[model samples]
Target: MSGDSTESDVAQETTDDDGPKTHSTSFKIARALFGGVLAFTALDNFRKLDEMIAFADSEGAPAAERSVPAISGSLLFGGLGIAAWKLPRLAAGAVATFFVAITPVMHDFWSRDDDEEKEQHAIHFLKNAALLGGALAFLRVAQDD
Candidate 1:
């Protein structure tokens, strides 16, 4: 066989069922960083459970006592799963749910009367919204994978 034909054959052989193959170093790094951030935040939440609960309570979240642990555990496991690329769709979904659930509850800037507090909450709310969008997109990509 000619060199060009042999090279084409090698490329075809490397293609995955999903599609054409490519190095995934950057993707892997991004996934790990995303997971690491979530995991670290979860650890912090656990370390400050009482404070988290108090903050949740102050924010008027229903069942703050029960929700704190549940959310923290979800964040820890979901983050790890994403990092490991294990059931990443589920992990991304969990993270997305967490963002959706907490956004309005914790950062309801509309409810704040003070301008500074309103702006602060609005910033957090928008940030979480962006994260949620990213998580959802990741979920789609994971599903495709």
Candidate 2:
């Protein structure tokens, strides 16, 4: 009889409340938006591979031509995984790695002599860094879950 009572209490505690479930809906939308950015960027990269490769070559990353496909594919699938809340940690880690690896290579502000170029590169570098931080935060949240 005591065990039955305890089970009933547990079930009651787990029951859903009558309040709006907006928090969950908002989280889902946020996740999809986050992943959408990555996926869209990946698609853009694929669509303009030649132009991207040319830009990379101009930036002294000639090998980017060979690597763009793999990078774009990672972003596409990783973003999808994140949006779907499936293997989010892994997806976030991959996105984070992409940002970290590309930041220095693509946004080498220190290597630029022109002030305008330097400032532009610096902005891009910092933006990527901030994105990396967001990805790390996502990973931490996923781990907490």
Candidate 3:
């Protein structure tokens, strides 16, 4: 405890024009957990490319064939970057962009006629909203750094 902490225990600190900021172990864990989830999900999407493309098309996504791969790639890159604290700004921005671009379009709960489907889509939309918040917070952290 007196010396440098291990990866899990390490707390990163950085200073900016305003003051100093500290990234706690909890923050790092949160980043890793969420980032890993996104990364894994992207890989899975890639594995089921045809299925994902079809889903995207069903969701009324334009140019689903091209956009699906591009989005998946960005997700993978952003997730890995954030988890590893590499290119943190770009990573966080990518995540934010992904959420902003997809949440309303893909999870259009308001457009659903079935109550159950609407509720499901609503939940997904809210979840993406929360994740977008996290991405913004991470972006701020990166900016401080």
The lDDT leader among the candidates is 3
**RMSD for each of the candidates:** 7.5, 7.7, 8.3
lDDT of 3 at 75: 89
Worst 10-residue lDDT window for candidate 2 reads 14-23
lDDT winner, 1 or 3: 3
Q: Give a tens-digit lDDT track for model 1, residues 1-145.
A: 5456475665565456656332367667878888889889999999999999999999998899999899889888888888888988889999998998889999999999999999999999999898888788778667556
Model 1 lDDT at residue 71 = 89
**Model 3 C-alpha lDDT per residue in residues 22-98, reported as the tens digit of each score:** 35566678879978998998899999999999999999998999999999899899898888889999998998898
Clashing pairs in 1: none
Model 2 CA deviation exceeding 4 Å by range? 1-23
Each model's lDDT: 0.85, 0.78, 0.86
Residue 11 shift from truth in candidate 1, angstroms: 16
Clashing pairs in 3: none
Per-model TM-score, in order, reads 0.84, 0.79, 0.84
